[model samples]
Target chain A: MITLYDFELSGNCYKPRLLMSILGLTYETVPVDFYPGREHKSEAFLKLNPFGELPVLVDDGLVLRDSQAILIYLASKYDKTGQWYPLSDPAVLAEIAIWHDFANRITATASAARLGLSMFYDVDIEAAQAGAHQLFRLLDEHLWFGEREGRDWLCAPSHPTTADIACFPYVALSEEAGVPRQDYPAIRRWLDRVKRIPGFTVMSGVFPAGPAIEA
Target chain B: MNRPNPYLNDHWHVVAGNEAVASGQPFRTVLFDVPIIIQRLADGLRVTAALAPEKPLPVLERYGFIWTSLGTPMPLFEIPEYDEADRRNMNAGSLGVAVSAPRAIENFLDMGHFPYVHTDILGAEPHTEVKEYDVEVSAERGEVLATRCRFFQPRAATSSAGGQEVEYVYRVPHPYCSVLYKSCPSDENRRDVIAIFCQPVGEERIVAHMLQSLIDDVSTITDMRRFQQTIFGQDKPILENQYPKKLPLDPRAETPIRADKSAIAYRRWLSQMGVNYGVIPLVPRVADV
Candidate 1:
């Protein structure tokens, strides 16, 4: 049995939950009140994760701290198709690794802006929103060209990797942070593609897209 | 602190689609930051102040939209094709954006972003150029019109199967509303009417209503809607990320290019009309300062 130390609203927490859902793993959640309660920073929670983060995944005596590390472990173990986190291709693996780091940047900027706007965190909102836009512009350009080259997703070009899952949540919730996805048309289309991914679970803000009509 | 412009309050803004509120069902929406409710009657629709239940607001049903005004409004704009039975008049629905209404209208009037923003659907790279267009302000008609515009598109419409040079004519009939008359896919002699009515929900937020009246029998409603929605979806992010949220009416606010003739004319029209609900205060030049 697997367990996730979760916060309902946190995009970071949703990352592993999304991967686990896609992997068809039945995991229980220990809901941590991240906002009013601040339970993640408490003494008991501190023992689980010294970083005081919301997501500390415990899989049958194996504990993981970072969301990316948890994803790597889960995809390696449960993804039977070998498509989500295929290990044989070093090129694809390197691409996934780079995007995993890019996901962390998204957390710092887009998620930070979201928390600053909605949760009343002391964030440099203007700076954070600007940073998020910068990242989105880069991602949009990447995806736009990728589509032209017959590549649909971020990594592997043919099939969606864990990179798409990792980078999705914050981009979907960007409007909550006062950042609109207006200029990034490619990114908007990509979001719809991600929402259409099977086993996609809905959180507080991210809703499922309508059925995609195939060409 | 948005000072609701009296001029804008007096103009017809599209509040909802015809199907937005059902008969006997109360539909809720906000206009100029004041939340209002729309009640659909057996004959037509009635809008009332949510807080003041006794007062009935001025409402009109026209061209697949339910329009209302907070104050006494001028006449609504006209699209001649709506009256035609052969045209497929579709309400592409509404979407809320963080930018001011004028900004949304301006984005709709722009064709330069096709290659970059819309990519392969509306336009592709290496074929990027907005040919010169003629813009006019019809004082008698109370509208700003731009004609003789053209752009290369990969897929101009859902019915289109390949690339073609699309001709366009843009019109700004109201401060927050702009309409596009583009080449119809099935018919070479006729043009499709696409409009974006920006409802100024707040000073810096708007709900854009897209209505596409087309001369096409080849495409289904689903395909047409998906095509227009895809185009608008691409424009949303660019519109929201624009700084200040509100549009700058002053010609000096942003540099103008040959392709921005319609945008420039629209700004000039808004300035002439004194519509200031969602615009920045004009800045004095260095020489004047």
Candidate 2:
């Protein structure tokens, strides 16, 4: 059995849950009050995670902290389709690693700004929003050219991988953080593609798009 | 930011969807940066400003929405088709858009961004031409009307299966409200009505309320909602990134082309009304000049 210490609103917590849902892996969540309650910072909770961050996962006694690490582990061990974490492809592996890092930058800036604006937190909102736009420009250009060359995802694979899931939540929730994706048409298209994934689910503020218009 | 602008204050803006103000529950929202709360009393909904809870403000419930104003407003505008038979009228829901009300109305009037912003749904590539359209502000009715607008769309509605040329007629009855009469998928003789009633939460914040009245029998309400939401979701990002975040009433503030006829007319109408709440007025600031 897999147990995830989760906050309902935390995008980091959602990352693992999304992959788990897509993989059809059954898991239970120990709900943590991350907002006004701040249960994650409780002394009892500190034993589970020293950093006081959310999304602490324990799968059959194996503890995992970071959302990216949890994703790699879940996808590696349970993804029967083998497309999410394709260990056989060394190039794909490198590409996924780069995007995982990019996803962290998004969390630091986009999620931080969201915390400051929507959630109560002492975040440097202006700097965080500026940082998010800088990263969005790069991500948009990469996806824009990818479409030109008939590539559809963050990675080169025709099929979506964990890289797509890793970077989706914060970018999708950028609006709540006041960092608009309007200037990035390619990025907007990519978000729709992500929503159309077979097992995609939605959190608050994130709604599903209708089925893609048949080409 | 919660200062007075009589032109807008005198017009109705949607505060909440009628369903949102449930009995025994209090619904809170902001209009023109002033927080207002609505509670279902024994008689009806009692609306009051957050700061002045003692004094009750007036509210008109109609068209699946709750309409309100800070001052005396003209009678609500007419939607003749709303009373017609055989239409599936719906409150498609509201989205909090982070842009001025005028910016949202401009985007709603624009057919030019159909190909780029709402690609493959409202429009597709290579069919980007926004054909010649007629735009005018009615002298007697005091409304902005744009007719004969046409565009090729890949999938115009949830019921649409393939591409088709969609005809459109745009109407702006209120400064923050826009209505679109588009080609209905189920009926050729009739048209689908899509309206956005923007609540000016602040100068740069809007709560866009959508009302869709369609002539479709095949598509489920959920499917229709997702279709409309998908289109607006696509537009939200593009709308939010507009440079000033406020629509400039100055004709020379931003460059325009023939394709921007309806939007140009909207700016002109707003300027004539002297709505200064969520727009950069036509006159330049002396310090900047």
Candidate 3:
């Protein structure tokens, strides 16, 4: 059985879990608590991943970290559905790469802003808010042009690929970081569509029961 | 300078405005067949499309489109009020039909499942409290109309320090489109709103129009624009994959766990909006309320 080292609430850790579930692969979830003494940095965990990020997937003795890399690996290794990862054309790979950059650069930044402001440490609120806005606007422009032209999936013609999986969590979770969903209805609608996918699972996060008051 | 088609295909058509779009005026495309009309409206940019009278439109087909304002691609659709018969036949293959209103509202109420479903990107935990709500709805011509509704949720860390809030808003224009606004506010009161307009094209798909702007003067718009571009680049893949041909919702398929609050609420909201709500089973465990 594959062993997934993860934190229950971490989005980065949840990626592999979501992928495994969607692909119907069985794995063991080893929970790591980040709040107490930095468990990820322990020597034993370091042997698995020097980076010490949660969500280290160990399958058949092959270890991998980084959510996107793990997702790519799992799909390439075990996915019976070729729609998840395609090695057919150069353009497809290029398209996947474009979204991979999106996940790493854009999504990471947004996630960081949320973490800085809400979870990790209280950083410069102004700077973090600015960063979040900047990211939202850029995404808005891209979607505007993309929708006008007809193509639905980011890279492929019809079906979703690994690229979509890479970007889904953070963008949807931006709202949790205090990024308003009302401002980006297109994105919200897109989120709704993603939720409709079969075998789709949500990331583990806290959501306010009532409407949140703006501070 | 030549700009590659954002949709990645050459055969799709693009709509710019009510007037025929010029061959090259920076318009968004949808489903490789229709073009969305983008224009500056009194509220913001209005995106719509004109369809030929003779065109064969589907019943409830939803399409994937992008809103430029946020640098994210979003799904857009046209859903008529549900008929009882239509509600019974809800399935993945028949998404074009309308569904229930109560179910849609229920979907909107659950917000706890963000982390598990999208994972790594959207959720970090399950079950957070909502701090405030702003809602506006009206009845039009004997039909229950949703003029606008905004919901806000605060993060835990900022909860004590007058935490930041995420806001969601929705608007509708009869036979034209629906506009949704999502915004974020920081502890320092810096705010940005991303506006998306969903316009119908044929029966299945709608074109998404977008605009994003920051309320803070601390940063230059150019800087904001660059930042928005990077963020949208990340969201492109998921949004692109979600539309045109979306996977059908199967309520009877699996029971969601306590972590799936958001997904559940979202489904209820869709039902309340008179759209079909899939019949996914609710997990037996109670969410951390």
What is the number of backbone collisions in each predicted candidate, taken in the order shown?
6, 1, 124
* Model 1 lDDT at residue B22: 80
> For residues A99-215, what per-residue lDDT tens digits would candidate 2 score against the true structure?
999999999999999877643367899999999999999999999999999999999999998899999999998988888787999999999999998888765457678888899
Distance from true location, Cα of B140 in model 3, Å: 56
CAPRI tier for the interface of model 3:
incorrect
Task: Point to the candidate with the largest DockQ.
Answer: 2
Top TM-score hit: 2
| TM-score of structure candidate 3 | 0.42
Residue-wise lDDT of candidate 1 within B1-289, one digit each (tens)? 5756787788777888887678887888889888899998787778998998899999988888888988899888888878899999988757667789888888888888888777787888898888878999998898899999999999998789799999998888888888889998788999999999988888887878889998888776655665676577567667777887888988888998988888888888888777778887565678898
Q: Estimated TM-score per prediction?
A: 0.64, 0.68, 0.42
The candidates' interface RMSDs, in order, read: 12.5, 8.9, 16.7
Off by over 4 Å in 2: A1-83, A86-164, A172-176, A179-215, B2-4, B284-289
Candidate 2 local Cα displacement, residue B98, angstroms? 1.3
Q: What DockQ does model 3 achieve?
A: 0.02
Which lDDT tens digits does candidate 3 get at residues A173-195? 66445465567655654555556
Evaluated at residue A163, the lDDT of candidate 3 is: 77
Error of 1 at A36 (Å): 36
**Candidate 3 ranges with C-alpha deviation above 4 Å:** A206-215, B1-289
